[model samples]
Target chain A: MIVFVSCIILFLIGLYAIVTKRNLIKIAIGFAFIEYAVNLLFALIGFKRGALAPIITQIDKPHNFVDPIPQALVLTAIVIALGTTALMLTVILRIYNRYKTFDIAEIRKLKG
Target chain B: MLFIPLLFALPLITAFVIPILGKIYKPLVWIVTTVVSFILFIIALYGVAVTQEIPMSVYKMGNWPPPLGIVMAFDSFSAFMVLMISIIVFTTSLFSLRYLSRFTGQWKFYTLFMLMTAGMMGISITGDLFNMFVFLEIAAISSYALVAFGIEGEELEASFKYMVMGEIGGLTFLLAIALIYAKTSTLNLADISNSMQVIRGTTFFWMIIGMMLFAFSIKAGLVPFHTWAPDAYPAAPAPISSL
Candidate 1:
């Protein structure tokens, strides 16, 4: 329970950084932090009380195996994060090219 | 029932196949993806129709029976989500046709798009929590890359922001899975649900609910947790945004 709460806390910290940071790159870093927190929470979820690897083999019977779902979920989530991160980087590059800096406040030339 | 898994599989196959084909012919990418999306949309609706009278639909994977083998099933909630995923995917593809011209890598866009579609479909149909996470990641990673597609500073910022929040959600979900494992010793969702049904009122049960609710809500991007969306959505190319 404490572990779960800590994960949430880590998530909040990342959120704070993303929200408060002025540098675009820093904000992106904040977002990365948030992803780490959530993935950590999930990994903890898959951990067994006293289990071994989730793989099932014949010679050695597996007992108390951890959940494979979270690991699977993590794989997918990581991919999604990777895609998002790549996309973000692309946008940041464009933004940097158009503007002179990675600062968010100065680059809003598109205001309605 | 088993055809349910195919909804996830088909698009994934398409995601991989089209990119390879796109290396040879560019136009092949859109057609293949569009057709795949159309098929999935039809199939999802069909699934709902077939289950009109029943309470739920279950598809055991690899001919394995329920409670013993892996399951891919859906109730009303999942069916609705499937509908959401496919419609969004189709509309996004339509939107992409015009909007993606500004971008150079047409094939890359479609690849991520199909991957996102497949991931969402996988999440909506799977009867295992871990599989749900995997699918969630597939959708997420694609979305992340999509967000950063333009490589503009603002887009990168948005992508990073989105990535941070998304990762947190993934971690929380992982924690939940771990806790549940500690208690129930299983990860197949149906079995988990069945097991959960027995201990509905315990502190542990609430723990499960808390983890899932927190994770999905973040993914869905509801009000308080929705800060990254406005930035990311606008930063993304219109078609990518739609995708």
Candidate 2:
């Protein structure tokens, strides 16, 4: 599907940012983008054409519903993404305070 | 049997309790950490003995069946890993008691260490694919914070680099899990393994395998993914690097 392909493309874009960008903040943003893309892909996986929200109200009535598992998984994934993103930003902030730069080239004190 | 959940629960509960205890009395955190990890090591030993007696044991969360709920599958391999993890964690906590005296926020180190232990233990015992991912993230995130515990420029930079690479691998893993779930319609490891047989050798199967391989190889620091490990290991403290 086009949506799935777009998700992969978004992920690739994030990867590209991480690999090529020199700014620490940009790289963090790239990681956020990647997390969002993956979470979107997971949520999209459970989407149904005409299915209703997965809610059961009556015992006798049967209703079409979208898969709820992926939705739940996405919620967990989002929380994890938030944790990683916050940590990444915090580290970046510390790096800026110590080195006084955002450029990766200038930040390199450890080398081969 | 009940020791299976205790493997993770004990450390997790201790991790949170450490910080609060640190507020009351700083040295109490160290004592609690040591006691908890020692208990965990014993539990892991029991797990190994029990698994040697029984081939496999399953603990259904909330009394739900395998296909419908998350389960903890304890087998020989899991027991082995759990034992290995506990041994390392116990020794590391002991080592840190003296090693971390120079550090101001030693309580944070023990907290993150216990959390990482819980995460690794959860990963080893979890029977659901998503549960594994959650535990993986928990461990990975704590390790990232641990790597940056010093707050030095180089440590922060290394942690940043490691986080980027690690998150990429983790997201790739999530994508693979999504694909697997889309195909199998189940998240339980046993259920998915049962359904996967029918789709074995298919292109989709291979794709998922390749993605998972890529992700795990990064986690394991395989040849191509070895860059982050060298930097991360050297930047972290001695015990954490060893861990």
Cα miss at A43, model 1 (Å)? 8.2
Residue B98's lDDT in candidate 2? 77
Residue-level lDDT of model 2, residues B5-34, one tens digit each, is 999999999998888999999988988888
Instruction: Give candidate 1's chain B TM-score.
Output: 0.91
Give the lDDT of residue B106 in candidate 1: 89
Q: Give chain B TM-scores in order.
A: 0.91, 0.98
Task: List, for all models, the DockQ compared with the true complex.
Answer: 0.29, 0.80
True interface contacts reproduced by each model, as a fraction?
A: 0.37, 0.76
What docking class should model 1 receive? acceptable
**Model 1 per-residue lDDT tens digits across residues B80-108:** 88888888877778667777777888889
Model 1 compared with the native: what TM-score? 0.75
